[model samples]
Structure formats: C-alpha cells, structure tokens
Target: MTVPEKRLHEDGDGDGDGSGANDTTALEEKRQNTQPYIKGIAGIKPEFLAPISSLSSTYTEYNDDEAEGGDRDKNGSQNGNGDKRRKKERGQNQKRDLKQKRDTVRLCVSLIDPEDESTPCVAGDEEKCKYSHNLEEYLASKPKDIDGMCPVFEALGYCPTGMKCRWLHSHFNKETKKLIKDLGKLETEKDKSFEVNLIDRESKIALQRKKYKYEISEQVIKYLDSKVQRNDSHQENRKENEATYVEQPFKIAEKKKIDLRGAKIVSPLTTVGNLPFRRLMKTLGADVTYSEMALSVPLIQGHQPEWALPKAHISEHPGFGVQIASSKHWAAAKAAEVIYRTTQHVSELNLNCGCPIDLLYKSGQGSALLDQTPRLLRIVKAMNGSSGDIPVTIKIRTGVKENKNTAAHLVDRVLNETQVAAITLHGRSRQQRYTKEADWDYIEEVGKVVKNWNEKREEDKEGRDTNPTWFVGNGDVYTYEDWYNGVAREGVDSVMVARGALIKPWLFEEVEAQQYLDKSSSERLSMLDKFAKFAIEHWGSDEYGVNSARRFMCEFLSFTHRYIPVGIMERLPPKLNERSPKFVGRNEMETLLSSSDYKDWIKITEMFLGKAGEDFQFVPKHKSNAYENTENR
Candidate 1:
C-alpha cells in the first residue's frame, strides 16, 4: 500500500481528502530532512533503511501512478505514462533475446580438442580439438607441431558427428594445394610429381569398392576356423575340431600384492608405448605400464611389425601390461593370443575403447568399441579363452558426449559379458579427446558401479567368480600429491600416468620417497643422457638414427619441462622460462637423471643416432586444458 495514503486512511483520514495525505507527506519529508542534522549529533550516517522493494510495495496502494512509477524513466524523473511505454519496450527486448537464444542454441555443442591435428582426427575434427599428432615423430621431422589431423589422406564429409551434422568445413582439398600451403613455400616452388584431388563421387565409389574388398575379405577370414585352411583341409584340424577347441571363460588371478590404497590407471595410448619406455617407467618406480596398443586385424594377419609392438623388454618383468584395440571377437582373441605368446611380462591385457583419434574411432575400434557391447563381450570372451594366468583389461572414456557416461553400462558389461582382469577409465567422453578434465567424480561413480557390479556378479550363478575386474583411472595426473589424493580414496584401486610420466619420469620415485627431490639443471641434463642410451638401442646408433633420436629427445623434454613443481625450486614461484632448482652442488645429478627435457632427450638420442641422425617427422599429441574436469576437476 502507498505508505502515505494508507497512513491517511489508517489514521481515519480518507484518501479523497488530498489535504490529509499531503500533510502526512509533508511530515515524512520533514523527518527525512532532519535525519542528516540528527546524524551529526550522533556522529552516525543514516545507513540503515527499509528495503526499497518493501517500501515501494507499501506505497503501491497509495497511487496507481506509483505502480507505473518504476516503469517510467528509471532516472526517477519522468512523468507517469512515460514509465508505461518504457516497460513495453523492455518486454519487447526480452522477447527478442529469448527468440535469439532458441534459434541459435538449439544444437549448440562444445567439444573436447586434441593437442595436435596434423596426423589424424582420432575423434573426428582437427580444428575443434587443438591436439597434435604423435609428438615423437613431430619432433623428429619438423621439431614443431603441425596443423592437420591426417597427412596421407583426408576424408570428405567423414566427421563423426553422426546426426548432428553441421556440414561446416570443406569436404576435401587438393593434395598439391595443401602441400604448398603446408610447406610454407610459394606455389612456384611446389613439386608437380604428386597430384591432389578432392574426394568426388567417383573417388568415393572407388574408396567404397576398396573398403568392401578389404573388409569383406577380413570378415570372411575371421569367420573361418583357424584349422580350416584350404590347403590343409585334409589335415587334422586341431584348433577347430570339437574335441580340440571349446568356448571357455576368462579367469582372474588372486591379487598377488595386498596394497590397495592407490589409483588404478590404464592407458589407451598403446601406439606410443614401447619396451624402452615401459622399462624406463618401471625403473622409475611406476606402479604399472601398458603395452603399445595392438590391432586385431594385424594380429590375425600375423604381421611381423604389428606383433613386434606387443614385445616386452626383459626388465618389464612384474608390472608390464598389454593393451589391444579391436572391434571384433576373433580379432581380439587373435591379438590377445599374440600378446601372450610374445610377452610373459604382462600382468594385464587391456582393450582400448577411449581413443578418439579418427583412425581408431572411425574403424569401430577404441571409443567406437563402446557401441557394440555384444561384440565387445564376444571379443573379451575370446581373450578369456586364452588369457592363461594373466588378467584381461579394458580402457575407455565416459561416453560419446552430452553428459552421458557409459561406464555404468560398460562396467556391467565387463562384469557379466566376460571375465575381465580390470577396467581403466579415462573420464572425459570420447568426443572430448584430451581437451578437458579427466572427470574424477565420474571415475568414482564408475568405481561405485564396478563395486556394486561385483556384488551382483558374485551372487549370480553365471558370474560366481569373486575376482572382479580392478578399476584403474587415468588422465592428467601431474603431481605425486594428486596421485595420492586420487588413489587414496575408497573407490580407486591404482592410478595410471601418461603425459605426467612423460613430463616427469621421477614422479613415482618422488611419491615413493614421500618428499620432493627437486633436481638441478645439471642433474636434469644427466637424465637426458640415460634416455639417449635407451633411444640408441631402440633406434640404432647410426646417422639415420642420431638425428631422429635428437628430435624425440626434444619431445620428451617438452613434456619434462612441465614437471618442475613449485615448492622445491628455491626460486619462489617457478616459471617455465626460469631456472629450475639447482642442486647444492653437482651432487644432485642422480635426481636430475630421473627427470626429462627435450634438450637432454636430444642429447640422449645423440648417443643412439650418432649425433647426426635426423629426427622422425610427424605430428604432436595434445594435452587437455580441461585440467579441472579430467584431473583437478
């Protein structure tokens, strides 16, 4: 109600009598005017007042003009009807804003990006994700991260957007034109030997034909029993005969070690894994290391180079892991068989389904494996058949995107479909690539689901085995303290490190020591030396090798540089450009030997490549900026 009018009426003075209301207003005005003078006596400014909204409400009934008052020029100086017109204009503007939001935001989406794009669209788009290709190769060739996802071929309209097709980019580009652009040279300097053509209808048809021939042949080969070779039809089919072969289930070994107070991490980055690297990690006190990812098709083909990736070093004895990427049952089975035969060093066999790289995702491998659960079951079952004493594992992201986490679904599948050794989860969706946080909460949620699943599995006649697949978490773990925080939680088993380890090899050691061992610059230089020796053995010590080794060293250094933690460096706040903590003397060399850096890495590579070898050329991988979501978040 209008305070003054209500006051007049409440005082038995009718509003019809303008005299009484005016008198009350005059009295209120006099009181307000005297407030400043009274404040001077008390030395207090009249700071407290009734809320404007409430005061305005009380005054509301006094006059309709007051109701329309706020609507007038907000300057509070406008005449009555002016407010009404302004109110109308405000409503119109609000309506317009809403309409704009509806039209533009219906299908808006934010996607995770890779660190590099020049190699392959592991998840689909390159530009959206800032991820580069493989770093080792990038350092070797260009010493720089490139600007594209895939180099050999670019598909037209091949984005993995599915139904959310925005059709925003050029479907194809001429190879020659792109080459000129990439070389950063003028067209006059372009080589004419190779031709580039956009993917047209004719080209697509030819591509389809090639795919049909390849895929159909592969499918047929996989369908045939191993013992059913045409030339050996007359021979005894030992593997295929009913008496010789039977569908069996996976068996999980009891936990050999009792320590369960840590994070269980798994890596989907098998391609970059190698014996030298895994061994180095083990030496560094890492809890575990995954084998480079293996492909089911190549294993079925018995390709020598492909099979070589699964090979374990003599030092990879206890915690070695073998990870495979596959979308078919027989292929998975075949790959597992090859891994087991080549490496007794493995404790776990991981299936990759979190990789968003277009090569793996588009082929129904990696994250694509999440879609065909029944198929995944079949594949895992095949692995179980020949798992032997080793455990079977799986690596995956949360889901495709849009807040969907398939861990709950896949957790159940892993529990019921096949006997798995463990599940390693990278928290971001496959669509996120390495652009966001690793999603620890979701990882915990998955952990809970797995725990619940185990209880149910134990109760079921079919899933009577008490051995549940262990839960392993990965993504963006940088510090030892972060590692402890993650695994020390109830839901986690053990954590895995990728880029963190690459950047700081001494992380595990630091955690084990329970104190920071900040290495000096000279000490870091020494670590690079050891890495060089390892690289030499892997790449050979020739000129063709040395240059390549130098390049990869730089790559390793790039990651290593990120590890200089804040506390140890006596130099207050640490900056990448600032000097790292120096050892008291040269005595800190051992600590430095445990670290990494591109410069030291190259120095190390020099030992192997003869100091003259050129670096391998390719793309760089991206580190996710979504630290809060995937790791810290």
Candidate 2:
C-alpha cells in the first residue's frame, strides 16, 4: 500500500551539475521557501490533510451581483432597498405567470390516425390517445404566416408529435386540408418502417411474440449452469475431478484482434454522452467512443431508450463500442444478440463492472459484479457467445473496497478462462470515488502481471491467432502529460477519459500536439456554437428540440466553466480538482461565459439558438453547491 514519493518533474530538467553549483543551491533554497499556487486539492500540502475540515466547505463564493455592478441596487432602479425588494417580487410574479402560460400550451400530441387500420382505437381505454382530433380548430388558431417549418416532418415524411407540435402550422397544408407526407427524404425502407413503428410499438410486439432468441447465450448459460450443478452434486468427489474442471476448455469463435494502442477514448457518460456529444468528440479527435451504459434487461425487453444508446453516428465507426450492464447471464446474452442482429456499427461489446452508482450496485449490476466473479464471468462469456465477430471487453475498478484490491486476480482469471479482447481498469476502488488520486503504481503492477501472462501464452502457441487482452488504464488523466506518464508507467495500451473530456473536450487536441492549449474566449464560444449546431441536427430545431439543446448546452457549460483559461493561470497544466479564486475574465463576454449561473449558460446558448422562451427552465444533472446563493434568481 506504500506509494513511492516522486517529484512531478523527476524525469530530468534540473541543472544540478558542478557548474554554477552556488547559483543552483540558491535557486533550490528559493524554490523551497516559495509556495506554488496549486490548483484544487493538489494545493493542500500532505502535512495539512489531518487538520483540514470537509473539502467542499473551503470553496470561495463568487457573487454575480457584485461582479456585475459595484454599487448598483439589485434591480438597477437607483432606488432604496424597499423599491428593490418590490421590483424583485414583481419579477417573480411575472416568471410565475409565464410558467402558467407555458403549462397551458400543450407540447405532447397524438400522431395516431383513427382511420388507419394499424392505429388501434379502444373505447374506454384510459391509455388510448386523448389528443384533439379536430383539425379545423388547430388550423383556425394558426397564424397567417409561418415563421419556420418542422424539420422532423421534412426529413421523416410525417410529424410524430402531430397537432401538439409547436411547428404544426408549417407542416400542415391548409389548401389541401391534409398533413404533408414526403417519402423521398427517407434513406431506406427500414427507416420508413421505423417511422411508422411510432412509440416503439413494433419493438414491443416483437418482444411479446418472442421473435428474438439468444441462441448462443442460452447454450453458454446452460453449459455453465450444468457445470455448476455437477460441481455442487459431486462436492465429495470435487478434489478428484478438480484437475478435469480446471483444464476444461470452452469453445470460442474466431475473431480479429482489437488493437487500441495510443487511442484517445472518451468514456461513456450518462445523460451527457448522447450521440450528438460522441459525434462532436469524434470530430475533435477521439479515436474510440463508447455508448452510455445501457441496462441489459431494458435492451432485451425492447425499450426504445435503451436501444437508442447503441445507435452511433456514422462518423464513430471502427472503434465504437456499445457498453451494457447486466446482473444476469440471460439479459446480457439477449441484449448482445439483439445488437448483433440489429446493428452493424458496433466494434465491441463491453461489460460495465466498474460503475459505482448506488442504485446500480444495489441492484446487483454495475460494480456489484466485481464481488460476484462467477456471475461476472458468465455474463461476459454469454455476451461473447451471442455477439458474433464483435469482441467482448470489460471496464472494471481496482476493487469494491479501499483495503482489498481484487482487480489483478480478476485479470488473471479473465485471461486464463475467457476470450475477452480487452480490459480497462480505473485505478481507484469503488470506495475511493474522486477523493484520492488514482493508484497508478498498482495499475502498473497489474499491467506487469498481464504482460507476463501474455508472454507465456504467446510462448505456448506458435501461431498468433489468439488475441492477447489489451489493458487500458482509466481515472484522473486530464492532460497530455498525464496520458503519457500513465501509459509509460503502467504499460497500458491506452487510457479512457470521463470527466476530463467533459471539462475540456479539447484534451485530445492537446494530446495530439503534446502540449497545453490556451483557447481564447472566441474560440471557446465557437466550440459551443458547433455543439449547438450538432445538437439541433440530432434533436431537431423545433421549440422542444431547441429547449432540449439548450438544456444539454447548459449541462456542458457546467463542466466547461470549470476550465481555467491557461492565459490566466499561475501555473502550467491545471489540475482537474482545482478551484479558483474570484476573478473576472479578460472580456465581458468571457466573464459572462465563465459564470457558473445556469441563467448565464442559457444566455450563452441564446447567442446560438436565439432567445429561450419565457417557459424555458433548466436544472443541471449535478446540482451546484454555489446555486444556493442565487437560487431565487
């Protein structure tokens, strides 16, 4: 458990020769006396760890009102405190009225046609479509001139949201007295069929009919079950048959090796790692990207949301992986079967055994699999059997607890018993969270073990047909230096970035240049603009779509704001965990852009998407402790 104490710049760059010895001694003495302003928690000296209270309580608050105007009243009315309070009250009332008006404007609508045979209309069925059927009423309410058209209707031939869509007027042809349908824009019959399927009806029907079967998964699961049953029954004779069981070989289909050496991988982030974000990362230089962790049970049951996770943008090929979390072998196998059958974009199927979220762990999925090694093995084996040609990979942690490190043992078992193509180990245990630095020393130790195993396996087999499992290190890699140092030290093939990518997606760009990038405010704004365009393309440019884009934009801003511009930093290579003192940006726009307020994030989005409707409101996925001071605003 003892980590070797090494200086950050120990590799060499010091002038410590006999020449200018007196000058070097003086410089070293000065360096020892001078305290460097470390970013975030790295600034805390090891000696101060015990006396420091909660790290969360130490952050300095930045008051927007003070930043905006030094002496102006809250309302900018030049009035006394009473007048300012009254104006604030009036503003609150106005916001409430706007919210009420938006509530009255229904956004969801029925797309079902009562006359169509495929559209079921059941009387007294509470779940049946209750949307207004009177087209004339909707037509009369429409304005004389349409400002914008519905992009969904233009692309997909029909509007799925129907009359409730805010842009219905643009899609509806008044003279013809019917909704316009354009089939030419659709790329394939399958695409057209999916549009007609509407609300995942076809998927549901297929699931209910049992049309999809996990042929390979079932066979593997059955085989594993029989072995377990046989072992249990022959407990008394287990020692006699132990050698036979240990040497048992499992059948695996031939597949090409997956090589991800020096690849820039963006971890599959929940809520934030949508298709649009992955597409953006690909454009920025991400070599490998994974889908958000889709639950296997939902994918097997044909849930639309779960199925959507596996869908990759056309640009994200060659190294696109679909990650799934499952507690049971059947669910993992069935989900893999569906992906293999339905999609051709997947390069690998990754089992998520490192997620530390309580809900997932409590449900016997995610990091819980780390504790249940036998079940984890079965799930991977089943998934591999079902996923034809697509290699199975796994993402794991050091272990579940701080004291016990089981990842090396797990790696040994996987290498010996399974045909997994790769393994990614996040260097922290589930209990460690982000409080401590990643255990790179331990990761290096495990990497050595894997290397030895691979060498031995290669010596045994003259042919290189069998692919050695590639090892990847994850956790706390933020810059080119970190990536280089981790890979060089741990001997990992590559590293996966999660929050680092979120905070500064251009980390890959920095890695490509092998240096830090001090992006200007305008350049940063342009990046946001590009993301907004991508979001509009994926989510559509309609009112709901615009709002959805803005919400996610705000989410991105929440992370992006944490990026301290290199120009303003006191040091090189900012730490991910560092907090900054109150400071204004170089320009007003930059200052506004750097504001942690969600309202300011919306304003930034408005520069791209136009002004948000009065009805628009956004709550960040991860709540900010700073919001308590300005929540009323």
Question: Judged by lDDT, which candidate is best?
Answer: 2
| Whole-model alpha-carbon lDDT for candidate 2 | 0.65
For model 1 the TM-score comes to 0.53
Q: Estimate each model's TM-score.
A: 0.53, 0.73
> How accurate locally is residue 579 in candidate 1, as Cα lDDT from 0 to 100?
18
Off by over 4 Å in 1: 1-272, 456-466, 545-548, 565-610, 613-633
Superposed model 2: Cα runs more than 4 Å off: 1-35, 38-204, 208-211, 229-251, 621-633
